[model samples]
Target: MKWQLAGSLGLLLALALVNVQVDVKGYTRSLATRVLGALTSPTSHFTDLETSETSDDEDAEISDTSETENSDTSETESLETSESEDLETSETESSEMSETEVSESGVYNYEGTEPLDLTQKLMDSANKKEEVRNTAGSEYCLSEDDDPYTGFATMTPYRIASTPLKADDVIPAGCKPVQIWHLIRHGSHGAHRNDYIKFEDELPHLRRRIFRARVHWKGQLCEKDLELIKLWKVSKMMSKTGNLSKEGVEEIAGLASRFKSVFPGLLEKKFSIKRHPGDGNKIAFGTGSQNHQSAVAYISRMYDAYARYVPVGSQPSKTLQFYDYCRNYIEGVLNMDKKLKPYHTFMSGGIMNSVLQSVSERLGFPVTVANVRVMYNACRYYYAWYRNKVSPWCTVFTPKQLKVLEYWEDLRVYHDQGHRFEINSKQACVLGKDLMDQFRNRVENGNTELYAASYFVNPEALVTFITLLGLFNDEEPLNEFYVPKTRMWKTSQFAGFGSNLAIMLSSCVDDSFWVSALLNEKPVQLPGCDSSLGCPWNSFIQYYDYLSDCNFDELCGSFSSQLAQSRHWYASYMNEQWM
Candidate 1:
C-alpha cells in the first residue's frame, strides 16, 4: 500500500507537470482530472487508465482556471425542483451530449468580426446546412459590430437603421405596382411588468454575490465589463412599468420613413395607409404603441402629410386580433402544458447546464439558472430597446452562452408559434384570407376598391402569420428532447419588433396580375410560387387556408378542434404528434 501510494503521488506530479507545460486542446487538462480522482481514492489503484473512456472534461467548470471554450462543462440550477437522482441523471446526460454534439454549429465571435445579426444562429444541424440568418450586418450596433444581441431570438430588435429594403426597386423589371398589403409586429417597448419586479427583488442579491465572487473572476472577464457590472442597476422605469419606450417610437418612425422612401407613389395619402394601426389598449397591453409612434414620427419624413382612419383592432374576429378569438390555441397552446414542454425540456438539458455554469464562472459568481435567466432577459431587453447603448448585463455572457440561451428561447417559440397545426392552419388563416381577399379584388376581378393597406399587431400573431406563409419552416421539426444545433425556424428574424410580411400585386403588360412577397423588406420566393417578377395570381392564392375550412367561430370551438384534428390536411401533423 505504501509503495502504491508513492507511485500514485509520482504519477500525479507528472500529470500536473504535463498539464502546466502543455495546454493542448483541453485534452491534457482532462487527463489530470482523472489522475486527481484516483489520488482521492488511492486504494482504487488508478483503475481509470484509459484516456478515451475516463476523460470527464465536462465537469465543475465554474472554477477560475477551468473557464475556456474547450473547458465546456456542467453545473446548473434546474428550472424546476427535482429529486437528487433526477438532477444527477440530467447532469450525466448533458455531459454525454457535449461529447457527441456537432463541431461547428456557427458560433458568435466576440472579436466583433462576425456579421452583426440580431437573430440567433439558425444552422440545419440535422443535415449540416449553412447557418441561415439575416445577412444585413452593416452598422446596426453603435460600436461593437459583433455584439451578440442578434442571438436573442424573439427579443432582437428589427434592424431599422441598417440597409433599406427599397421595395419599389425589388419588383421584377416589367411589373408595375398596383396594390400592397403589410402586416407588422409591434415595435420595441419597456420590459414586462414581471421583469421589473424580478429585477428589483432578485437581481440586487445576485449583484452583490457577483462582487463577492470577483476574486475568482481574474482573467475570466474584462475590467471594463466588470466596472459596468458593478455600476449596473435596475432602470427607474419601475415607477411606470411596461410603457412604450422612446426607442420603440424611433423604430416605428424608421419604419414609416422606409415605407415612404421605398414606395412613394404606393404609400400616398390617396392609398389606404392609415394614420396609426396601433392597438388602443393601455401601455401594458398596447405593444403596438412603440412602432406605431415611431412609424407616426417618420411620416413627416415620408410624406408631406399622412392619411385616413382605420380603428386599430377593428378587423374581424381572428382577422386582426386572432389571439383573443382563437380559443383552442389560447387554451391549448398559450395557457396549457403542451407548447412549453419543449422549452422546459431544453432548459433542463446539458447545454443549458453548461451555459448556467459558464455564465456563473464568467461573472465570477455561482449563479442559479434562474439568476442567469433573469440576467439574460435584462441583457436582451436592454440591448434591443436601446440601440445606441450597450447594456451592462449584456457583457456578462459570451457568444456561446448567448447562443445556448437563444436556442432556449427558440425552442419555446417553435412549440408555441412556429409550425404548430393551429398556427399553420387556423390562427394563421385569418390574416391569410384577409390578404388574399385584397389580392382577388385587384387581380382576378379588377375591382379597384383598394390599393394599399398596413396593419400592426403583437409578435404572436405576426409569427403565426409567417408560419402560415411558410417563411422559415425547417425540413426537420424541432424536438423538445434534443436541440438541433442548426435549424431554420428563427423567431428573431421572423418576428422581431417592426418585422413585417408584405405582398404586392403588380400589373404586367401581358394583362395578367402577379403577386410578390417580402419579409422584413427583403423579397423572397413563396414555396410553390417561386418567381422573381411575381408568381401568377392563381399560384399565390393557394397559400391561403380557405375560409370554408377555417370559420372563426367553428375553429375556435372545442368540438371543432377534435374534428379539425381528423381532417386530411392535419393527418401528417397528427402522426408527428404521436411520433
Candidate 2:
C-alpha cells in the first residue's frame, strides 16, 4: 500500500510538470514533447527507489494542482480566440462605416495628376440583343452641342416675398364655385345602412329585402354594381370593409366634421354639405350620393382651411356634378398601382417587358437591337427618375397635360404661401425646373448670394418664408439635359406633392433638421433667414441654428395641434345624427 501511494504521487508530479510546461511553451512541438514525456515516465518503481509514501492528503493536493493548471490553460486559450474574433468583426464594421461616411460626404478626389478614364465595363456586357428603345409618343429637342437640358432659362425661381400676403387673396368669396372635382365610388350592391349590423342575425329576411330593393332598381344600378354595394354594406357593418365602406354613419360624421372645419359658417348659413349635394341629385339615395358625399367632405374641409386666410368679397357660384366627378377621383386612386408597375423590374422588366416587346415587334417597328437598347435606356432612366423623384401617379405635366399641371402648381404655390400645407411646399418648388436651373447657373458662375436672393426680392424674409412654405434649393438639377429651344441643361419635375415633401426635408438643411422638426412630438424652432450667401447655409450646424432661431418649430406645433383636434371629427356622432 505504501509503495502504491508513493508511485501515484510521483506520477501526479510528472503530469503536473508536463501540463505547466505545455502551457508555458504554447507551441505544438513543445506540447507534443511534453505529452510524450508524460506517457513514457516510469511505470515500475520497486527495489531501492528513494520514493516517499505520500499521505492520502498530499496526493490529493498534488492532483488538484494538475487539474487546476490544465483548466486555467484551456480557459485562457478560449478567451484569446474569442477576443480575436471580436476584433476582426469590429474592424470589418468600422471599415464599412468609413466607406459609407465617405460616400455620403460626396467628395471625389483623384490621386493621379492626369484624370483617369473611369467607365463601367460591365454595362457593355448587358444583353445587347434584348435592348429596345421606345420613343414613339415622345419628342426630343436635344441641344446643338449635345448638352442636356438644364431648365435654366425656362425655370427661374420666383421670390416668395415678391407676392404680398393679402388677407383677401387667399379664398375666393362665396366661391361656392365648382372646381372640376373627383370622387371615390361606392360598392356595387348591399343592404340598407341600418340593417348591416344585424345582417348575420337576420340574413334571410335581410336578403329578401335587399333582393326587393335591388330587383326594383336592377336596371338603373346594374347587376354588378348592386351586388358590390350589398357586399360592401355587409362588410362595412361587420367592420371588415376598408375605405369608403358601408359604415356610412361614422364615415359621414367624419365628412361632416371635416366640412365644418373647412367651411366654418357655411354649415349653418346658406349651405350645408348634406343638403347642398342631396337636393335635386338622382344620387340622393344611391351610389351617386356616395360620390357627392366624398366631394363635399373634401371641398368642405379644404375651403374652410382656405377661408381662414383668404377673404374674398363675393361668393363664387358653385356647380355640382355626380357621376363624372366621382369617376375621375376613383380613377386617380386606382391607377396608382398601374402607373408605378412600369417602374418595377418585377412589373416592368418581368411582366410588362414581354408584352411590350411583342407589341412593338408586331407593330412593324420590330424592336431592333439598337431600338431595344434605347428603349431600355429610356425605361431605365424613367424608372430611376420615378424612384428618386415624386409619386408616379400624381399627375405629370407635359404639353397636353400642361394646363392642368400649371393650375395644380399655381394652387400649390398659393396654398404654400398661406402655409396650409407647408410640408408639400418645397416639393412643388423642385417641380419648377426652370427656377432651379437658373439658380444653379448663377451659383456656378460665382453669384451664390445673388442666386439664392434671386428666389425672392427681399432676402431678409428668406428664412421665415422658406420655413412657412417649406421651399428649398434642391429643386434645381445638377446635370444638364436638353430642351428644344435652348442649350443642353438639367431639368426638374418639381411638380408633385411627394417631391414637395422631400425637398422640404432635403439634405441641404442641417442634420435631419427639417424632418426632425416636422416629426418632433414637441414644438421646435423655425429655421432662420440668411443675409449672406456665405453664411454657411449648407452647414449642418449653421442650418440647425437657423432652424432653432426662426420659430418655425412653433408654426409646425400649431399645424400638428390642428391635426390632432381633427381626430375627434373622424369619430361617429351620437348627439347629432344626419338622416
Candidate 3:
C-alpha cells in the first residue's frame, strides 16, 4: 500500500512540475497545455469545451513570414506604402483576451528619445545580441530562442506570429456548436514589384556604402551578422514578384487543418462550403489566381481532395470589395501629400529620426530613413514567406527598435484601413450582414444541413469588415502623436495575412443560440459579447440587421470616380466600372 501511495505522490508531483507555466513570445502559457496537447490528437472527437492539442506547429501561431498589382495607371509605389493597399503577401493573430477596447485608451510604447550623435564613437559590445544565424539557404525554423515576432502589418504571418488559444477558451460549456462562419484574407504573398526592384537596385549601393565606410559598428552589430549582411543575396523568389509564395499555400493549409480540428463537426467535409476563385495560378497583382489557390489549398487539405472543387472566379462583388466603388476614399488617397501626411509625419518624427540616425551610425554609412524602411521590409517579407528561416536583415534591429518599426506600420494602417474614417467601417456592413445570416439560419430553423461558410477576400476588405464590427476599435485613434503598444488595433495581431475572424453559432440545452467570436483563432469579446456565454443570437443578428438590403452607392452618397487605384481585383483587372 505504501509503495502504491508513494508512486501516486511521485506522479502527482511530476504532473505539478509539468503544469508550471512558461512565457513564450510575449504570451504567458502553462507547460500543462503542452502536456495536454501531447495527449490529445486534434483529429479525435472534438468537444466545444476542449481542444488543447499542439502540433510541431511551431507557431506561437501557426506564423512563420509574410503583395501585388497589375494595371494601366502608372505605378508609383515607394517606401511608404498605401498601407496594405498594394501588399500582396499570402500573408498575415492572438489567443484569449485578445481584444480590449483599444480605440480610446491604452499605453503607447514610444516616447521622444534624444537623437543619436553623428560624431559619437561607434561601438559593438555586450549589448549586441548573442544569437546570430544566417538562414538564407536553410529550411530551419521555429527556434524557441528566437525573439518574439514583431508584427509587420499585412506582411505578418498570421498564425506563426500570434499566440494560440487556451483550449477551453474556444466555446463555453453547455453550448453545442452547430456552425462556423469564417472570413479569411489571402496568405502571405510575394514582395511588391517595387520592393523587389528596390531590393535588387537600391540596396546594393547601400551595401557598398556599408562595406566601404570607415567606422566602428562592432558594438551595434555582431561581426557574424555584418558578414551575413555583406554576403546577402536577393532571393530568387523575387522573380515571381506579386504572387502568393509556397509558404502562403502552407499557411492556408495549416489554417484549414486547425479549424477542422478545433470545430470538427462544423468543418467536416459534408458540411464544408468554400466559395473563392477556382483559378489554379497563384494570384497577386489583381489576378484571382492567388485567392483561388488559397481557397484550394485550404479546402483540399481540409477534405483531402483537390479535384472535387470546380473552377470559380475571384470575389469581385462590390459588396465586400466596396472600396472600389467608394469615390471619396479613392480620390482622397490620390493626393499623396494629403493622404499620407499623418504617416509621413510619423515617419519623419523625432522618434523615427532617432531610429534612422542610429541605424545609419551602426552601419557606418549615410543610410536614409527610406533605407531603414527597406531593410525592415526585407526582414518582415522574408521572415513571413520562409517561416522556417530568419532573415539576415532581421539582425539589424534590437527588440526596442522592432517595436518602433511595428508602431510605424500600425500608424500607416490606422489611417488607411482603420478608424480614421467611419466611411471605411460603414462599407463593411455588407460583410457583417452575410456573417449574421448564417447564424440566424441555424437558430431559426434548428440545424438545417450543417454549415461551414468560408469566404476569401483581400486585407483591404478584411480590415474594413473588422472596423464595421468594432473588432479592434481603440480608444485613441493611431496618429503621429504616439504608439499605443497596449492597444487592440495592432495590425500584426488584428490584420495579419491569413488572418481570420470566425463567428461560431452554438446551441444551448436551454433552447437558445449564442455566437462566439474568434479573431485569428483566439477568443475575443466583440463590443457586447458575453464574457462567458459569448453573444446571444438575437444580439448578434441585430447588429448587422441594418444591412438587410444595403447598397454601396447609397452608403457612399452616390459617389463616382474614374481614378483607378488598382486595388480592386474586379475593377482593375476585370474592367469593372465603379460608377
Candidate 4:
C-alpha cells in the first residue's frame, strides 16, 4: 500500500514538471519571435530596437539551444539570462540613439557649425604675409604702416562710388531723369580750426621731448622719422585750416564730372541752377566760404556756362542748417557734456594712458592725451592729403586702442548730432518739407522752371536729412541706439568727405513720377517706398507729408522740458543719497 501511494505521487510530480517546462519554453519562444520581428522590421520606428536586440540574439539562441540539449535546469537558467541581457541592450541602444539622432540628419545645419577663432585666423594671416618695410615706398607714397584708425567710421575717406548709376539700365524702361536735387557735403578739406589749434599747442613740446629722448632710444627713432618730425612746420600745415584745400576742390569736381557722365541727358542741357536765395542772385564766392567753394567746384565741372546760379546765404535756408536753430539740439548739447562724462573718464583712464606711453616709447618722446589728440588730427590730414593713403602718425596707436578711440568718437557723434536722440531727426522735418515743396512745384509746373537744385551743406545736416527721409534702410530707431554695440548708421557711408545724396525725379511713360536716391553717387532704394522700378510719386508725397507734420518748435520745447526734468530728478537723487 505504501509503494502504491509513493508511485502515484511521483507520477503526479513528473507531470507537473513537464507542464512547467512546456510553459517556460513557450514563453521564451514568444519573446524570441517578437525580438526577431523587431530586428527585421523595415520602418525607422523599430531600427534602434532591432539593432540592439539582434546583436545578442545569436549568442542567446546558441546558449539556449546548448542548454536545452543538456538539462531543463540549465536551459531555464540560460533563457532567463538571455531575456535580461536583451532588455538591457535595447535600453542602452535607445539612450545612445536619442543623443545621436540630432546629428544624423542628412541636411547641413549651419547652427551646428563651429565658430571661427578670429585670433587664430589673424595669426595665420599675419604669418602668411610677407614682412612689411618700415619706410614709405616712394617720396610721393605714404608709409607702409597700417593705420590703426582705419576702421573708425569717421576716419574713413571717400571711396569711389561702388554702384555707379547706370541711368539707362537702372531707370525704368520708359522713364527719363527730369529734375535732380544734388544735396552734397563739402569735399575733403584741411583740419578743422580746433584740430589745428591743438596741433600747434602740443607739437613744440612733443618735438622737444623727442629730441631729449632720442639718446635713450636706439632703433626706435629712425633717421626718416627724425627728419619728418623736424620738417613738420605747424604754421605752414595749419594755414589751410577750416578752408577747403586743392584736393577738396578736385574731389568735388571729380564727383560732379561723374554725375555728368552718369546722367548726360540731364546735365548736358541748359538747366536752370537754383540755390537757396538768402545770399542774393549772384554766385557769392567768398560769402558762405567752404559751401560756396564746393558749389563753385560742382558748377564749373557740370554746367560751365549753361546754367544760372542763384546765390543763397546760410541765414534764410533753414533747410540746410535746421539743426543750428533747433532748441532741442542746443539743449542736447548742453546736457551732452554730463552724459559724455563717462566716456571722458574712460579716455583719461589707464588704457588710454598705456597707449600714450607706448606711443611715447616708440617715438622717443613723452606723449600726453592732448598730444595724442594732435597726432590723430595730423594723421587724418595727411591721410586725406595723400589721397586715401595711410600716414606714419597713424602708427602711434594699436588697432585695439584705435577701436576704443573710435567708439568714443562714435558715442559723441551719436549723442550730439546723430539719431541717438529723437530730436536730432525731428529737426530734419524742415528739410523734408522743403523737398516736398520742390517736388510738388516740379510736378505741377511740368519740370520747366527748376531743372536742377543743389544744396551744399555740412555732413551733420546731410545725415539728419537722409535719416528723416528714410533713404537708407540699415538704420535702427533712435531709442535703441544705446542698447547695442552694433552701429547700423556709419559715418563713412553717410557723412564721408564729398558725400552726396542725389534724389532724381523721373517721368515714366505712364505719366507717373518715380523717386530714387543716390548715396555717395551709388543708387540706393528708398526705405518706405516699395517698388524696385521706383517709388510712386504719391507714396513719396505721403511719406514727406507725414514727416513734415513734426513741428520743429514743439519738438524743441518738449526736448528742452524733458532735459530740465531729468536734471531736476538727478539733483534730487544726489541730495537724497547724500542725506
The estimated TM-scores of all candidates read 0.65, 0.17, 0.67, 0.62
The lDDT, on a scale of 0 to 1, for candidate 4 is 0.57
Instruction: Estimate, for each residue in 366-400, the C-alpha lDDT of model 1 and write its tens digit.
Output: 67777887788888777777766667777777776
lDDT of 4 by residue, 506-569 (tens): 8889988888777776666676677544577888776667664767777665435554345233
**Relative to the unseen true structure, what is the C-alpha lDDT of residue 109 in candidate 1, on a scale of 0 to 100?**
29
Candidate 3 lDDT, tens digit per residue, 1-579?
999999999999987655532222112112222322233222222221122212212211322223112211212232113212211110111123322221112211223432222111011211121222122212222222365556677678875554564435757678777777777887878776666766765555554445433121122455455555655666433556546788888878888788778676555534234433222212221235556678777767776754365343455445556677676665554233543557777767888888877676566555677788778888888787776665667766666677788888776666767888767677776677676565666677664553666777778788888887777777877778677659877788868778888777777788888778788878878776657337777876666566555566676555434444445433232111210
Error of 4 at 92 (Å): 70
Tens-digit per-residue lDDT, 277-388, candidate 2: 2222111111233333333433344344432332211321111111112222223221234333212222223323443454243222223322332222222222222222
Q: Name the runs in model 1 displaced over 4 angstroms.
A: 1-149, 160-163, 215-219, 236-242, 269-318, 338-340, 422-425, 542-549, 558-579
Model 2, global lDDT: 0.27
Top-TM-score structure, candidate number:
3
Give me candidate 2's TM-score against the actual structure. Answer: 0.17
Runs off by more than 4 Å, candidate 4? 1-142, 145-156, 159-165, 168-170, 218-227, 271-288, 306-318, 339-361, 364-366, 388-392, 398-400, 444-447, 470-486, 530-534, 542-544, 557-579
Ten-residue region with minimum lDDT total, candidate 2 = 451-460
- Ten residues in sequence with the least summed lDDT for candidate 1: 121-130
TM-score computed on alpha carbons, candidate 4: 0.62
Give the candidate order by descending TM-score.
3, 1, 4, 2
**Top candidate by lDDT:** 3
Candidate 3 local accuracy as lDDT? 0.59
**Stretches of model 3 off by over 4 angstroms after superposition:** 1-145, 165-168, 214-219, 270-288, 310-318, 333-340, 445-450, 542-549, 557-579
